[model samples]
Target: MAGPSRFVVHVPFTAPDRAEARQYARMLARVLGRLPEVDPAEATVSPEDDQSVHSRLFCDRLLSGGHRCALRAEHEAPCAVVESDR
Candidate 1:
């Protein structure tokens, strides 16, 4: 059997301090959880950074819709979609 399809969603934000970064990450996590195509329980949010954020989302099915939603949610985020080759 093959593994599930994977996606990397990059979320970028600029914050003046660590406190703001922490707060923003939590808020964004909620939004990502609410995405119709995402299974929040199966998603993994990586460490937050002062300049960017990223998450690894897994699904049994295709994820183009989910990718599009993430990009649309934050138009300024420098995000890209790449399908797993493995």
Candidate 2:
């Protein structure tokens, strides 16, 4: 079988506090986990990039939040495959 693909999700953030990055990452992980194609247990979220769209979405969703999500589906699949393999 073909290997799973690798993708990148740019979670954007602006003028966020130090904790904001990790918080946004966690929130993003939860949201991404909800995706139909995503495996909740296998799903992983991290500071993939600075000033990313996902980070911005997290921030934007809340009154004080200003994180905007930029998830690219195909890239993250490999991680799921890797997680499952382990």
List lDDT for all candidates, in order: 0.48, 0.41
Question: What is the C-alpha lDDT profile of model 2 across 1-86, one tens digit per residue?
Answer: 99677565544555366466555555566566666565333333445353332222222111223322223233333222212221
Reference-based TM-score of each model: 0.39, 0.38
Question: Each prediction's Cα RMSD?
Answer: 11.9, 14.7
lDDT tens digits by residue: candidate 1, 1-86 = 99677685756677776456545655665466666555443444445542244443322233456653333232354555533222
Model 1 weakest 10-residue run by lDDT? 68-77
Best by TM-score: 1
Clashes of 1: 0
Task: Give the C-alpha lDDT of model 2.
Answer: 0.41
Error of 2 at 54 (Å): 15
Off by over 4 Å in 2: 39-86
